[model samples]
Target: MMRLELNLLIEGLHDFEKAKRLGSLSNEYCRESATIYLSQEDSSILGVSDGDIVEVSSKHGSVKVRARVRSDVRRGLAFMPPSPYSMALLGLDEHPSIIKVTVSKSSGEPTSLTTLFTS
Candidate 1:
Protein backbone atom coordinates (compact mmCIF):
# COMPACT_ATOMS: atom_id res chain seq x y z
CA MET A 1 0.00 0.00 0.00
CA MET A 2 1.14 3.53 -0.76
CA ARG A 3 1.60 5.76 2.26
CA LEU A 4 2.40 9.44 2.18
CA GLU A 5 3.78 11.40 5.07
CA LEU A 6 2.80 15.03 5.27
CA ASN A 7 2.00 17.84 7.61
CA LEU A 8 -1.44 17.63 9.23
CA LEU A 9 -2.68 21.03 10.20
CA ILE A 10 -5.36 21.20 12.85
CA GLU A 11 -7.50 24.10 11.82
CA GLY A 12 -9.12 26.45 14.27
CA LEU A 13 -12.84 26.29 15.04
CA HIS A 14 -14.88 26.19 11.88
CA ASP A 15 -18.33 27.77 11.70
CA PHE A 16 -20.19 24.48 11.62
CA GLU A 17 -17.90 23.15 14.33
CA LYS A 18 -18.68 26.10 16.54
CA ALA A 19 -22.40 25.70 15.94
CA LYS A 20 -22.17 22.04 16.85
CA ARG A 21 -19.96 22.67 19.87
CA LEU A 22 -22.95 22.95 22.18
CA GLY A 23 -23.95 19.47 21.14
CA SER A 24 -20.62 17.77 21.40
CA LEU A 25 -22.23 14.37 21.20
CA SER A 26 -24.03 15.25 17.99
CA ASN A 27 -23.34 12.98 15.07
CA GLU A 28 -22.68 15.95 12.82
CA TYR A 29 -19.83 17.18 15.00
CA CYS A 30 -18.37 13.73 15.22
CA ARG A 31 -18.55 13.32 11.48
CA GLU A 32 -16.88 16.66 10.95
CA SER A 33 -14.18 15.93 13.49
CA ALA A 34 -13.52 12.53 12.06
CA THR A 35 -12.78 13.88 8.63
CA ILE A 36 -9.41 14.71 7.04
CA TYR A 37 -9.10 17.00 4.08
CA LEU A 38 -6.59 15.81 1.52
CA SER A 39 -5.50 17.29 -1.75
CA GLN A 40 -7.04 15.72 -4.84
CA GLU A 41 -3.60 14.72 -6.04
CA ASP A 42 -2.73 13.12 -2.71
CA SER A 43 -6.04 11.29 -2.60
CA SER A 44 -5.49 9.98 -6.11
CA ILE A 45 -1.97 8.93 -5.26
CA LEU A 46 -3.27 6.91 -2.34
CA GLY A 47 -6.04 5.41 -4.46
CA VAL A 48 -8.69 6.84 -2.16
CA SER A 49 -11.71 8.95 -3.00
CA ASP A 50 -13.69 11.35 -0.92
CA GLY A 51 -15.40 9.63 2.01
CA ASP A 52 -13.06 6.67 1.84
CA ILE A 53 -11.58 5.49 5.13
CA VAL A 54 -7.91 6.33 5.62
CA GLU A 55 -5.42 5.66 8.38
CA VAL A 56 -3.44 8.67 9.56
CA SER A 57 -0.55 7.92 11.86
CA SER A 58 1.78 10.18 13.76
CA LYS A 59 4.64 9.46 16.08
CA HIS A 60 2.10 9.39 18.87
CA GLY A 61 -0.38 6.98 17.29
CA SER A 62 -2.72 6.22 14.43
CA VAL A 63 -6.33 7.06 13.73
CA LYS A 64 -8.69 6.04 10.98
CA VAL A 65 -10.86 8.76 9.49
CA ARG A 66 -12.80 9.67 6.37
CA ALA A 67 -10.87 11.34 3.57
CA ARG A 68 -12.31 14.53 2.09
CA VAL A 69 -10.58 15.25 -1.19
CA ARG A 70 -10.42 18.96 -1.79
CA SER A 71 -8.58 20.97 -4.37
CA ASP A 72 -7.91 23.70 -1.82
CA VAL A 73 -5.54 21.53 0.16
CA ARG A 74 -1.92 21.45 -0.86
CA ARG A 75 -0.40 18.30 -2.30
CA GLY A 76 1.90 17.67 0.66
CA LEU A 77 -0.27 18.97 3.44
CA ALA A 78 -3.55 17.89 5.03
CA PHE A 79 -6.14 19.66 7.14
CA MET A 80 -8.16 18.39 10.04
CA PRO A 81 -10.54 20.03 12.46
CA PRO A 82 -9.40 20.69 16.00
CA SER A 83 -11.10 17.91 17.91
CA PRO A 84 -10.30 15.06 20.22
CA TYR A 85 -9.45 13.01 17.17
CA SER A 86 -6.85 15.53 16.09
CA MET A 87 -5.57 15.88 19.61
CA ALA A 88 -4.94 12.17 19.77
CA LEU A 89 -2.63 12.37 16.80
CA LEU A 90 -0.82 15.41 18.14
CA GLY A 91 0.02 13.78 21.46
CA LEU A 92 1.89 16.45 23.42
CA ASP A 93 3.35 18.46 20.61
CA GLU A 94 4.16 22.09 21.40
CA HIS A 95 2.76 23.16 18.07
CA PRO A 96 -0.39 21.06 18.20
CA SER A 97 -1.90 22.65 15.17
CA ILE A 98 0.75 21.34 12.79
CA ILE A 99 2.23 17.85 12.93
CA LYS A 100 3.60 15.24 10.61
CA VAL A 101 1.52 12.19 9.80
CA THR A 102 1.45 9.23 7.49
CA VAL A 103 -1.72 8.77 5.46
CA SER A 104 -2.84 5.72 3.55
CA LYS A 105 -6.04 4.17 2.29
CA SER A 106 -7.72 1.92 4.78
CA SER A 107 -10.70 -0.43 4.84
CA GLY A 108 -11.30 0.08 8.55
CA GLU A 109 -14.04 2.12 10.16
CA PRO A 110 -13.48 5.63 11.47
CA THR A 111 -12.13 5.84 15.00
CA SER A 112 -14.74 6.63 17.60
CA LEU A 113 -14.36 9.48 20.08
CA THR A 114 -14.76 7.13 23.01
CA THR A 115 -11.87 4.97 21.90
CA LEU A 116 -9.75 7.89 20.74
CA PHE A 117 -8.32 8.89 24.09
CA THR A 118 -8.45 5.43 25.60
CA SER A 119 -6.15 4.07 22.95
Candidate 2:
Protein backbone atom coordinates (compact mmCIF):
# COMPACT_ATOMS: atom_id res chain seq x y z
CA MET A 1 0.00 0.00 0.00
CA MET A 2 1.17 3.52 -0.69
CA ARG A 3 1.89 5.76 2.29
CA LEU A 4 -0.16 8.94 2.37
CA GLU A 5 -0.37 11.97 4.62
CA LEU A 6 -3.09 14.58 5.04
CA ASN A 7 -2.69 18.30 5.68
CA LEU A 8 -5.56 20.03 7.44
CA LEU A 9 -5.55 23.79 7.69
CA ILE A 10 -7.91 24.72 10.49
CA GLU A 11 -8.70 28.39 10.23
CA GLY A 12 -8.84 30.63 13.29
CA LEU A 13 -7.85 28.42 16.19
CA HIS A 14 -8.23 31.30 18.62
CA ASP A 15 -11.74 31.99 17.41
CA PHE A 16 -12.64 28.34 17.81
CA GLU A 17 -11.14 28.36 21.29
CA LYS A 18 -13.25 31.37 22.24
CA ALA A 19 -16.34 29.76 20.81
CA LYS A 20 -15.59 26.58 22.75
CA ARG A 21 -15.19 28.63 25.91
CA LEU A 22 -18.63 30.12 25.35
CA GLY A 23 -20.07 26.56 25.12
CA SER A 24 -20.30 26.62 21.36
CA LEU A 25 -18.30 23.40 21.17
CA SER A 26 -19.30 22.17 24.60
CA ASN A 27 -20.64 18.87 23.29
CA GLU A 28 -17.52 18.07 21.35
CA TYR A 29 -17.05 14.88 23.35
CA CYS A 30 -20.53 13.56 22.97
CA ARG A 31 -20.98 10.05 21.63
CA GLU A 32 -23.29 9.10 18.78
CA SER A 33 -24.33 5.91 17.06
CA ALA A 34 -21.74 4.65 14.55
CA THR A 35 -21.69 1.52 12.43
CA ILE A 36 -19.08 -0.08 10.16
CA TYR A 37 -19.88 -2.78 7.66
CA LEU A 38 -16.99 -4.84 6.37
CA SER A 39 -18.77 -5.36 3.09
CA GLN A 40 -22.24 -5.48 1.59
CA GLU A 41 -23.47 -8.61 3.32
CA ASP A 42 -25.97 -9.79 5.89
CA SER A 43 -24.75 -13.07 7.41
CA SER A 44 -21.77 -11.42 9.17
CA ILE A 45 -18.13 -12.43 9.45
CA LEU A 46 -16.34 -13.86 12.45
CA GLY A 47 -12.83 -14.52 13.85
CA VAL A 48 -12.08 -10.95 15.01
CA SER A 49 -12.85 -10.00 18.61
CA ASP A 50 -13.15 -6.88 20.72
CA GLY A 51 -9.99 -4.99 21.74
CA ASP A 52 -8.26 -6.34 18.68
CA ILE A 53 -5.95 -3.94 16.94
CA VAL A 54 -7.19 -3.10 13.48
CA GLU A 55 -6.27 -0.55 10.86
CA VAL A 56 -8.82 1.76 9.22
CA SER A 57 -7.80 3.67 6.16
CA SER A 58 -9.12 5.74 3.31
CA LYS A 59 -7.85 7.37 0.15
CA HIS A 60 -7.01 10.47 2.18
CA GLY A 61 -5.28 8.75 5.17
CA SER A 62 -5.07 5.75 7.50
CA VAL A 63 -4.72 4.99 11.18
CA LYS A 64 -4.38 1.98 13.53
CA VAL A 65 -7.16 1.54 16.04
CA ARG A 66 -8.93 -0.96 18.29
CA ALA A 67 -11.99 -2.91 17.24
CA ARG A 68 -15.13 -3.45 19.30
CA VAL A 69 -17.27 -6.10 17.73
CA ARG A 70 -20.93 -5.82 18.56
CA SER A 71 -22.75 -8.75 20.19
CA ASP A 72 -25.81 -8.69 17.97
CA VAL A 73 -23.99 -10.48 15.14
CA ARG A 74 -24.49 -7.84 12.50
CA ARG A 75 -22.37 -9.50 9.85
CA GLY A 76 -19.68 -7.35 8.29
CA LEU A 77 -20.18 -4.70 10.94
CA ALA A 78 -17.92 -3.27 13.65
CA PHE A 79 -17.78 -0.35 16.06
CA MET A 80 -15.04 1.86 17.43
CA PRO A 81 -14.55 4.59 19.95
CA PRO A 82 -15.43 8.13 18.94
CA SER A 83 -12.23 10.02 19.61
CA PRO A 84 -9.74 12.29 17.94
CA TYR A 85 -7.85 9.26 16.74
CA SER A 86 -10.94 8.23 14.82
CA MET A 87 -12.15 11.71 13.92
CA ALA A 88 -8.83 12.89 12.47
CA LEU A 89 -9.64 11.45 9.09
CA LEU A 90 -13.16 12.88 8.93
CA GLY A 91 -13.90 15.94 6.78
CA LEU A 92 -15.39 18.87 8.66
CA ASP A 93 -16.60 20.78 5.62
CA GLU A 94 -20.17 20.79 7.00
CA HIS A 95 -19.26 21.74 10.55
CA PRO A 96 -21.87 21.33 13.31
CA SER A 97 -24.13 19.64 10.78
CA ILE A 98 -22.39 16.87 8.88
CA ILE A 99 -19.27 14.72 9.04
CA LYS A 100 -18.24 12.66 6.06
CA VAL A 101 -15.90 9.75 6.83
CA THR A 102 -14.20 7.50 4.30
CA VAL A 103 -12.63 4.42 5.82
CA SER A 104 -11.31 0.97 4.89
CA LYS A 105 -9.08 -1.78 6.22
CA SER A 106 -5.50 -0.77 6.96
CA SER A 107 -4.19 -4.09 5.77
CA GLY A 108 -0.39 -4.66 5.69
CA GLU A 109 0.14 -2.22 8.57
CA PRO A 110 1.61 -3.29 11.89
CA THR A 111 -0.66 -3.80 14.89
CA SER A 112 0.17 -3.27 18.56
CA LEU A 113 -1.53 -3.89 21.91
CA THR A 114 -0.78 -0.47 23.33
CA THR A 115 -3.45 2.14 23.85
CA LEU A 116 -3.07 5.81 22.87
CA PHE A 117 -3.30 6.98 26.49
CA THR A 118 -0.54 4.73 27.73
CA SER A 119 2.65 6.52 28.77
Candidate 3:
Protein backbone atom coordinates (compact mmCIF):
# COMPACT_ATOMS: atom_id res chain seq x y z
CA MET A 1 0.00 0.00 0.00
CA MET A 2 1.05 3.56 -0.67
CA ARG A 3 1.18 6.09 2.09
CA LEU A 4 1.11 9.80 1.29
CA GLU A 5 1.31 12.90 3.39
CA LEU A 6 -1.91 14.87 3.03
CA ASN A 7 -3.15 17.97 4.76
CA LEU A 8 -6.17 17.13 6.94
CA LEU A 9 -8.71 19.87 7.51
CA ILE A 10 -10.83 19.43 10.59
CA GLU A 11 -14.31 20.73 9.88
CA GLY A 12 -17.43 21.43 11.88
CA LEU A 13 -20.02 18.79 12.58
CA HIS A 14 -22.24 17.74 9.73
CA ASP A 15 -25.95 18.36 9.93
CA PHE A 16 -26.69 14.71 10.52
CA GLU A 17 -24.11 14.60 13.25
CA LYS A 18 -25.54 17.70 14.87
CA ALA A 19 -29.01 16.19 14.77
CA LYS A 20 -27.60 13.11 16.43
CA ARG A 21 -26.40 15.38 19.28
CA LEU A 22 -22.66 15.05 18.52
CA GLY A 23 -22.04 12.29 21.10
CA SER A 24 -24.43 9.66 19.89
CA LEU A 25 -23.04 6.13 19.72
CA SER A 26 -25.42 4.97 17.03
CA ASN A 27 -24.14 3.20 13.94
CA GLU A 28 -25.33 6.04 11.69
CA TYR A 29 -23.40 8.56 13.76
CA CYS A 30 -20.33 6.41 13.74
CA ARG A 31 -20.53 5.91 9.99
CA GLU A 32 -20.86 9.61 9.30
CA SER A 33 -18.29 10.78 11.80
CA ALA A 34 -15.75 8.15 10.84
CA THR A 35 -15.59 9.19 7.22
CA ILE A 36 -12.77 11.06 5.50
CA TYR A 37 -13.27 12.99 2.31
CA LEU A 38 -10.42 12.93 -0.19
CA SER A 39 -9.82 14.47 -3.55
CA GLN A 40 -10.07 12.30 -6.61
CA GLU A 41 -6.37 12.67 -7.22
CA ASP A 42 -5.49 11.70 -3.71
CA SER A 43 -7.89 8.77 -3.82
CA SER A 44 -6.38 7.58 -7.07
CA ILE A 45 -2.87 7.84 -5.70
CA LEU A 46 -3.84 5.78 -2.71
CA GLY A 47 -5.87 3.38 -4.86
CA VAL A 48 -8.88 4.02 -2.68
CA SER A 49 -12.51 3.99 -3.72
CA ASP A 50 -15.46 5.50 -1.95
CA GLY A 51 -16.38 3.64 1.25
CA ASP A 52 -12.96 2.00 1.34
CA ILE A 53 -11.37 1.87 4.76
CA VAL A 54 -8.17 3.84 5.19
CA GLU A 55 -5.74 4.38 8.00
CA VAL A 56 -4.86 8.03 8.67
CA SER A 57 -1.95 8.68 10.97
CA SER A 58 -0.05 11.56 12.46
CA LYS A 59 2.80 11.95 14.92
CA HIS A 60 0.18 11.87 17.64
CA GLY A 61 -1.82 8.80 16.67
CA SER A 62 -3.69 6.91 13.95
CA VAL A 63 -7.34 6.13 13.16
CA LYS A 64 -9.14 4.10 10.56
CA VAL A 65 -12.02 5.66 8.64
CA ARG A 66 -13.98 5.17 5.48
CA ALA A 67 -12.78 7.19 2.48
CA ARG A 68 -15.00 9.23 0.20
CA VAL A 69 -13.70 10.59 -3.07
CA ARG A 70 -15.00 14.09 -3.56
CA SER A 71 -14.51 16.51 -6.40
CA ASP A 72 -14.71 19.47 -4.06
CA VAL A 73 -11.57 18.38 -2.26
CA ARG A 74 -8.22 19.47 -3.66
CA ARG A 75 -5.28 17.25 -4.29
CA GLY A 76 -2.96 16.58 -1.36
CA LEU A 77 -5.74 17.57 0.96
CA ALA A 78 -8.34 15.71 3.03
CA PHE A 79 -11.40 16.86 4.93
CA MET A 80 -12.99 15.32 7.99
CA PRO A 81 -15.38 16.59 10.62
CA PRO A 82 -14.46 16.90 14.29
CA SER A 83 -15.15 13.39 15.51
CA PRO A 84 -13.49 10.68 17.51
CA TYR A 85 -11.67 9.30 14.51
CA SER A 86 -10.14 12.64 13.60
CA MET A 87 -9.60 13.50 17.23
CA ALA A 88 -7.73 10.26 17.75
CA LEU A 89 -5.32 11.21 14.99
CA LEU A 90 -4.90 14.77 16.25
CA GLY A 91 -4.51 13.59 19.83
CA LEU A 92 -5.12 15.69 22.95
CA ASP A 93 -1.73 17.35 23.27
CA GLU A 94 -2.02 19.86 20.43
CA HIS A 95 -4.86 21.28 18.40
CA PRO A 96 -4.41 22.55 14.86
CA SER A 97 -7.09 23.51 12.37
CA ILE A 98 -5.15 21.69 9.73
CA ILE A 99 -2.27 19.23 9.91
CA LYS A 100 -0.32 16.81 7.80
CA VAL A 101 -1.24 13.13 8.02
CA THR A 102 -0.05 9.87 6.51
CA VAL A 103 -2.88 8.06 4.69
CA SER A 104 -3.06 4.61 3.20
CA LYS A 105 -5.63 1.91 2.43
CA SER A 106 -6.56 -0.29 5.36
CA SER A 107 -8.59 -3.44 6.00
CA GLY A 108 -9.57 -2.43 9.51
CA GLU A 109 -13.03 -1.31 10.56
CA PRO A 110 -13.88 2.31 11.20
CA THR A 111 -12.74 3.47 14.61
CA SER A 112 -15.21 4.56 17.23
CA LEU A 113 -14.88 7.27 19.85
CA THR A 114 -15.26 4.76 22.66
CA THR A 115 -12.25 2.83 21.47
CA LEU A 116 -10.08 5.94 21.50
CA PHE A 117 -10.88 6.87 25.07
CA THR A 118 -10.83 3.31 26.36
CA SER A 119 -7.50 2.50 24.75
Where does model 1 exceed 4 Å of error? 13-19
What tens digits encode model 1's per-residue C-alpha lDDT throughout 18-91? 74666878888888888899999999999999999999999988889999999888999999888887888876
TM-score of 1: 0.91
How much does each candidate deviate from the true structure in C-alpha RMSD?
Answer: 1.6, 11.1, 2.0
lDDT (tens digit, per residue) of candidate 3 on 75-102: 9899888877777777556666688899
Clashing pairs in 2: 38-76, 44-75
Q: Rate the local accuracy (lDDT) of all candidates.
A: 0.87, 0.35, 0.85
lDDT of 1 at 65: 94
Per-model TM-score, in order, reads 0.91, 0.37, 0.87
Which prediction has the highest lDDT against the true structure? Answer: 1
Q: What residue runs in model 2 are displaced by over 4 Å at the alpha carbon?
A: 1-46, 72-78, 94-119
Query: Scored by Cα lDDT, where does model 3 land?
Result: 0.85
In model 1, where is the ten-residue run with the lowest total lDDT?
12-21
Best by TM-score: 1
What tens-digit string does per-residue lDDT give for candidate 2 at 1-119? 32222222222233334444554224332211111323223212323344333455543334565344444534433333343444444554535222333333343332222332241
